[model samples]
Target: MNNIHLLDLIQGASGALDYVNSTVTGHHRRVGAGAAAIGGAMGLEGRDAADLVTAALLHDIGAFSLDLRLDGLDFEADHGDHARAGFRLLSVHPMLSRVAPLVLHHHTPWHRLPPLSDPGPGQADTPAAALLANIINLADRVDVLDQVGTRRVVRERIRQIISHNAGTVFAREAAEAFLDLSAGSEFWDKLSGDWTHVREAVDLPMADDLISHDQLLPFSRFFALIIDFRSRHTATHSLGVAETSARLAALAGMPPESQDRLRLAGNLHDIGKLAVPVTLLDKPGPLTQEEFEAVRLHAAASESILRSVPGLDDIADWASQHHERPDGSGYPHGLKRDALSLGSRIVGVCDVFTAITEDRPYRPGMTPDQSARVLRDMVGQGSLDADLVALLLDNHAEVAEARREAQARAHVEFERYRSLRVDGAAHAA
Candidate 1:
């Protein structure tokens, strides 16, 4: 296990979530900033503050997996199902299990909360968790409120809303802290202006336990779920790429560490695609120039999201460059042959291979021979790396087997997600 700042990873995940919908771009970050401010005002220090911010950033994670049309809905209107879904997702992870309940009750009103003294079955029902959840509830509501016109007018209106909900939607202490913090114009300015800076200002206590590459691999897989789970067409895309890339790296005789990094890069290469609309991604017909341009921006977005992590810089670079061509005809940053690293080249190859071999909305999966021809054609056009393509072709059976196995597992997960939606809908109806 390696010593890593867990907060940085959370921030990166938050960045990916921001891309899910451009309208809600900074929603998570703003909520996190507000929660941290409220936490500070309530005299929370060290780990308490850090945990609050972490929960806030991931508070809406369940929404990503949901089918809800969340474009303009207010916090109270959306209810608590997504909160329950998010709690279930986070609680499964060892590093994030502690904050699971905070997310679960983020939308729960203070009046409905169980008394802190008699928390229910789970530790998640404790006073600390409730306080953190209430703070997130207040912060999330604050971020979604209208902020049009003058700062003074906006602040006054927001303050009134917060005050009106006190002891009900908002815990009295959390509401009081936010009300006190809102009196200053700086608070409003930071919320509307540079929320990233505000979030960066607060330092989270470092984790004493370190995570190794083996342990960290599960985190990458989790992200793959977040990226591909949004639509059925792309459900197995990231996992296939991860498996294919690792297999290719092994065939190329790269060291074990390089192979692991390659697999991680493959899992994250499409992390930026979260920003592209699900409709756009699932469109069967050809895209408009504007839509294609939006699709192209994911590469750059992937880099921006992952670049901030401490030990993941190399992985970030490779993942971001997955779309770059050897001929400098690629998007985001059209780096030429020599400028691209070997790891980048391998990921680029695997990404294209996986896409061609996978079932897409408009097209069926290609046969191995068919995919080989397309890859060869790209190589001839000076786009793909010829040597890598040749190596992949030489080991076609092994590469295909790896991709099938990985994607088969992803298919099971996708079916499970679909089943949940069906059950939820049936229950609702």
Candidate 2:
């Protein structure tokens, strides 16, 4: 496996979350950058800073998972439910577990914060975690501060708000760091302007410290949950495709390394769909032409999101090209048979097969024989690769069984997350 930067992966995931809602687009990036600046002002410049940035970038992930509407809401609006949900989501992964508690208490006011010696239940309760959460809380509010007039006026008003809330809504040290940093115009300029490249401004962990493929597979599974759990229609789509595609790739005699890439591609193939709203995804009827066109853009979006990471170019290509046809007629790109790789072809075939085989709100799932006939028809139309279609037909039982097993696991995960959301809401109420 190639070496990949952990910061790059976090940056890519931040971009993916932006697509969840247009109103909150770029929200995470701004918070991450601002939080890093605060960390630096407080004399944190190494792994501690990097971890703070990572927490900020993924702070809003639980909101995406819950399909919450954040548009037009105040910066300090009630978000405890989503914050708790985010804590639960990130606590499960080894790489993200340390940062999980920071996300949980990001919305907690400074006055409400528990003492380090007596931190409340489920809280990490360390001084470092508390400081990190406070930094993130202040940074998040800074990004969402209402701007109604000139830039200078808005900046001054935001500074006043932070200063006024010091020792109450904001931690004294964290608030002081932010105020000292914001006293100059450069900080405000960077915060309000193009800040997508802010990750480059800070010192992140070295590429050598990056996790290996084995470690990455679990993170990818966690990502699949974030992508698929938003809607019942897509609750198990990524897992089904991943399982079926890997099985088909093995049947085609591909090497194990190549098969692994195919499976990763399968898990991320529809990651761009995160940009599409749950309303559109779960619509029970046919999409209008405009909606269909909007849907087509997801393929290109997926490619753009994955391209940001340093390595895994092969996985990005295969995942993005799943929509391209063998003929020159497919969407996003009109690449013909010569341009598409075998891995891409395999993913394309499995994607279609999985969609037809899975039950949808609009229609029931088709039987294996029924889905096979549809795949064969597509092959006849020059849309799908005939050889890959043959692989599916010859091993229909095994392929179908793999898809079923994977989806079963995904369904259980989705239910668990659903229960968490409900419980969080009830507790908040």
Candidate 3:
């Protein structure tokens, strides 16, 4: 946990965001690569360069908050809501605070942006925030254009659109930088090539040092907010599960460190849900076999994303194994009781409790007796660990109350986020 690299975490989180749609599968990585190249050509180096690329990777993050789909591929779509939402979400992050302003204006037109005074001798020639943001804007559109057609056609069209929009949609310098970079076959090769090679091509600085455990909480919660905020029906689900799982872990006599890890696992258990379509998630009737199969990929998706980051193996296992059953009936993997870890069982129990108790778009939450009965039946059928199920059922009042309080707080945050989207749309209009 202590040895997790900052860049790996950021990449993993961005990877989850990429799962939101098929059209934008690797959009963030390409944008990050493009921004790095453009920023370098503009003489951005060190922190300025790194922040710009980082912001590019996360620029569309507000899509989840706004419940947006693939509209980002439409160059003329209204992106103000997602841009503002990304700003609001990133502003509170401890390590990512500096990039918030960059993400905030990633969609702003060059002509509409406020002017900035040139920095003193030691600083970069341009104000880093403004220039960095414009770099992302240019890179983003370039990648979007790249998605429209074959390489030859897309390259020509990219030149035309970028040339036309310079000084309007994009800053003149950034646009020029991008045009120059994209003229080469090398640029397109890296853009369409592997991300590791892209980083080397652009000389992008990735933070490889270990991040402290204290920093993991905010990032975990950041992910939880993104995962749950995709729909009104699920706005507070991850928080409920996280808090409930933590309480249950405590009651189970787990050590303090294990409890903290379990909390992180709880917050991120459904991260793969980002890959699932909102229609499937909110559908009222039972899922068709095809739909159920699509939904079932979430657990493996969660494990894949989490495992991509170093030193998060324990957390990843705990989070991804939440669907496993003691009788080897669970999906993604059919681990039996002997194969399941206690941490995994704890998160699994909490997830079930939260799901049954939380209100859905189609129905009200189940009563305590109803939820308890459900849990007990699962215990009896070997679907869950009996002792853990009993612990949650016996202290139902306390654990359920903790979940309520946590989700209540999360709801307020969600409402505030909604207000930001409304205000942002108005501002954009």
TM-score of every candidate relative to the true structure: 0.88, 0.92, 0.90
Over the stretch 1-429, how does candidate 2's per-residue lDDT look in tens digits?
A: 678878778878888988876676778888887898888888876556767888999988877743565532465577776777787788677788677777877787877765433234543547777788889989988887733222424777888999999999898898899999899977766666654566554544432367678877777788888878877787889989988889998999988888887888888988898888777877788999999888888899889888877797999999999989999799788999899998999999999999999877667889877998899999999999999899789988999999989998888887776665321233231
lDDT of 1 by residue, 1-429 (tens): 235566667777887887765676678878888888888888887666767988998888877744743533454474566666676567656667677777777777887765433223434546777788889988887877743122334668889999999988788999998889889877776677643643454444433334577767878888898789877678889999998999999999999888998989999999988887878887788899999998999899899888867678889899999989999999779998899998999999999999999887667989988999999999999989999999999999899899999999988876665454311121111
Weakest ten-residue segment in model 2 by summed lDDT: 420-429
Clashes of each: 3, 0, 0
Question: What are the per-model C-alpha RMSD values against the true structure?
Answer: 3.6, 2.9, 3.5
Compose the digit string of candidate 3's lDDT tens values, residues 1-429: 458877677778888888886566788888888888888888887778778877888888877633555465577776776777787787656777667767767877777655433322332233567778888888888887777444434587888899999989888999898889878888887788754634465776565545788889988988898888876678899999999998999999998888889889999999999998888887778999999999999999999999888789989999999999999999789999899999999999999999999887778889999999999999999998999998988899999999999999988977776565322233232
**Which candidate's lDDT is highest?**
3
- lDDT preference between candidates 1 and 2, better one: 2
Candidate order (lDDT): 3, 2, 1
Deviation in angstroms for 429 in model 3? Answer: 5.4
User: Which lDDT values do the candidates have, in the order given?
Assistant: 0.79, 0.80, 0.81
Model 2 CA deviation exceeding 4 Å by range: 45-47, 65-67, 115-125, 146-153, 193-196, 205-208, 420-429
Task: Give the Cα RMSD of candidate 3.
Answer: 3.5
